[model samples]
Target: MEKPLAYRMRPRNLEEVVGQQHLVGPGKIINRMVAAKMLSSMILYGPPGTGKTSIASAIAGSTKYAFRMLNAATDTKKDLQIVAEEAKMSGTVILLLDEVHRLDKTKQDFLLPHLESGRIIMIGATTENPYITINPAIRSRTQIFEVKPLTEADILTAVDHALADKERGLGDYPVHMEENARLHLSRATNGDLRSALNGLELAVRSTPPEEDGTIHLTLEVIEECIQRKALTHDKDGDAHYDVISAFQKSIRGSDVDGALHYLGRLVEAGDLAIICRRLMVIGYEDIGLANPAAAARTVNAVLAAERLGLPEARIPLADCVVDLCLSPKSNSAYMALDAAIADIRAKGSGDVPDHLRDSHYKGAKDLGRGLEYQYPHNFDNAWVDQQYLPDKFKDAQYYQPKATGKYEVALGQQKNRIEQWRKESRQKPR
Candidate 1:
């Protein structure tokens, strides 16, 4: 059986590698390793189709090392042990373990001894964050190289190479792909080369053999083959900004259905975690003291989503989203801070007013830092008029908590005390 297009087109040497100019290019670490004929156990960390596995294969192929491959998704600890035992017999062995993050802690521990002793040069590939998912001890022993997604130009070069290679690709198929169609495929694949090539192959295969024997690919054909239309919430595209704007506005407008719809769109399009985090910020910025619980709830929801990890965590996120939307709305705190910052920026830095300066340190009293500062606790009502602000803005009121929800009751009590204090203080001889 013929190999898949992505596999067939895999780079066999460093020279053939398409992307990752940072690492695999000239004067790079990997290039040095290849030239020196010295290999180190390393972890390739990144999103899918970033040439993690291909890099490993190219290293094994170009060098004299005995190469072995395994998938963490399927392989057991026993399989690793077996490979390790076999690698011990071979002078140098290169073990490529794909999806290494999927291996549980106990399973991962099995390779620790072999990796440390240099019994095998391990190359691990993982899409997940290795810091959280992999065993710390194992991770510490492995050098980590991060691979990035291919750029549009890189993908285009790859497509051109694939279309021109007669033995390995569909050169005989007279298919002329439109620029729009190519761009659509690049966007839809989300920087995954395997996905893009698979998409191209599908588009080519589905096109009927014509009289001229030429297959012309249009945007509609590419969209149809891919099935999933590029969404308005693509993380790397302009749509991301527009969708998030809509989501925030919907929540601010108290349009629950609209908010939920936008939220659904973001969640389905794999931007839930980012959305949840933004909602947490919005809770504080938009809701503020009017509903202090809104910020706390949103923060808890983000934490829950992080700990629980998807589908299950979506419930908590949804709950926070609803609570934030329904909560008593106020941006008074946001406005207050904005005004404060504007003043600070315009004025540069102001002197610390003596009464508000640090007073606990030795000799502070001689400097008049706390010379006449009143102790509110010593007064009858446990309240006293004091100069807390700077001399330049002595009566400036930045944080005016809105009278809404729980803050309403608290603000009422605070206002009564302030009025009483003012009446007594004013009656006193100046």
Candidate 2:
């Protein structure tokens, strides 16, 4: 059987690689490595279809080295031994190890000797953050580079290249793709060249040619062929965390549109667990004392979402996200608690004040515990000056209230009155 269009259109050399100018462009690391023919074991990591495999193939082609492909997760030690034997005969062989993050100890031990001997130039490809997922031994042995998502223009360039190449692409066919349809094909795949090229082939093969003997590709045709836009969210990959970070930051920054965009992505990925967890955090961490009611409502919204489930769950999530984006923001309460925690961690918490300590036990008065304790409720405004903090931290102030909302403003005013009373009490004669 003939190879698929995507496989057939793999870059023959570094020059044929479309995107990743940062790595493959002139004077860049990979380009310099190729130019010098000084191949080294390396790892390329990023989202799917962003040209990790293409880079490996291009490197092998440019160097004229024998290229071999195997999956770290599936291919056995025997397959690695075969590649090692090829390296022994050919002087050097480039091995493309897919899913290198899943490499087990046995296969790793077999490959390490070849990698160290410079007989096998290993190019590991993964959709994971290699630093986090790959074993430290393997990671230490290779150079790590991140392949970024291709731009729309980059996707269009590759698509055009595929369409114009007769031997490997669709240049043999009398196919006429409209400009909008071409743009849609590039955009719809969301930077996946494999999807775009294969989708193009599917559209061409499935559609009937006009009486004039030309396949006319339209927007609808390409849209139907591609089916759905590829979302760059692998729960086990870096993109998942990146989206969650953006979602929380957008809401905290009060950008309704930006927050909604990220929320929509999470919704599309069906990550209700993360959504609920993050929203509840943002409600307290970002909205806090400024709008406690909004934060409470956010919790209720999350509960509703959990009960309703996705598709329909997105409705309440959207409502909460919008409310959070527009609500008055304050982190004063948590910040105050964090400050006290830092002090306790650094200087250590001193003993509780004797006056504040429990004194209901036998012979407690002899220990002076609660001996001078005064009940604030017996005084005016249900308030009185008393030592509440440990004597060592008597002057420490952790609660710095913000005036972002009416409720916090009232609390701030009350705090000022208490501070004034404490100052007066401290100055008075004992």
Candidate 3:
């Protein structure tokens, strides 16, 4: 049987490849590597259908190197051995390891020697972050490059090429696809060019040609084949950042309903990691010092979500989102740091006060370092007034606790007490 439209439509050469201008455009890194046939072992990472496998194929095609493909999720150790043997005999082999994140130790052990020997030029492809998923030993051996999702224009270009390629595509059929249908295929796939082409193929091949020999592909036919509509925010696309921004702002604004709504959208898209990270950011940047308990709870929930994974993950995630939204918010710490940083940039870092310098080392007392440092533990209520900042910043205060949350309210009261202590100490003798 003929290969699927996606497989047949794979870019056979560099010029045919679409998207990832950062890597394969003229004078780009990958282009230079391919032109010189100096391809090294590397890991290609990113969302699916952005052309990891296609690029691997193109490299070998251009270099005329012995090429082999293996799916790490299914292929056995023996499969790797076969490729390794071929590579040893051929002097070099381009081994495309798909789902490389799933590569087991047994297979990795077999491939490592070949990689070190420079016999197997491995190209690892993964949808997940390789640094987090791949074993460090294997990762260190391969350079990692991310293949970003194809844009709408890139997908449209690929579709147009497929519709015109007679030998391998749908050129034999006289078809006219509607603008909406074309747009749907391009955008709905969420940058998966292979998916767009496959959907386009199914819509074209299934629809009967009209009496005039034009197989007009309407939006209805395209929708029927594709089944799912494009989401407003893609998990790995530009809209993903927007959704995260909105989710964080909603929590910061104490808008529980808005926060939950955006949280649900992200959960449905199956990106627990992104949600977990956003929760942590919200805890510190948005909820800092206002509710220490909330920040702690958010951290615990993130741990639980990661341990449980998926369906159960959403439970902890929901708890976190709700807590974060309902809790009193503050950007005091965030602003405090920014204020301190601005000072540091405007004025040079002043020298540490002599009293604050280390006095534990031998002969340090000769220089009078830490000579008059006041031990706070010896004072009343374990609080004492002393110059902790550098000489020029003796009166500088970077932290200003907000009274928005109960925790910060207590902190504000403590701040008042400390100021009173400082006043009393100034009038007293050393």
Q: Highest TM-score: give the candidate number.
A: 3
* Model 1 spans with C-alpha error above 4 angstroms: 76-78, 81-90, 102-110, 231-430
lDDT, each prediction = 0.79, 0.89, 0.86
All candidates' TM-scores? 0.60, 0.63, 0.64
Candidate 2 Cα outliers beyond 4 Å, as residue runs: 229-320, 329-430
Error of 2 at 427 (Å): 23
lDDT of 3 by residue, 1-430 (tens): 7788899988777887889889988999989998887788999999888999999988888888888999999999989988877876778999999999999888888889888888999999999998899999999899899999899899999999899999999899899987767776776677888888889889998999899989999766876787643334233445656777999999989898999999888776566767887899899988888898999999999999999988799999988888988888888988988988888888878998888899999988999998999898998899877778777777788888888999888989998998998898898987
Summarize candidate 2's per-residue lDDT along 318-365 as a digit string, tens digits.
999999999999999999999999989988899998888899999999
**Rank by lDDT, descending?**
2, 3, 1
Considering summed lDDT, which 10 consecutive residues are worst modelled in model 3? Answer: 228-237
Error of 2 at 273 (Å): 16
Error of 3 at 110 (Å): 3.5
Error in Å for residue 33 of model 1: 2.6
True-structure RMSD, every candidate? 8.3, 12.9, 6.9
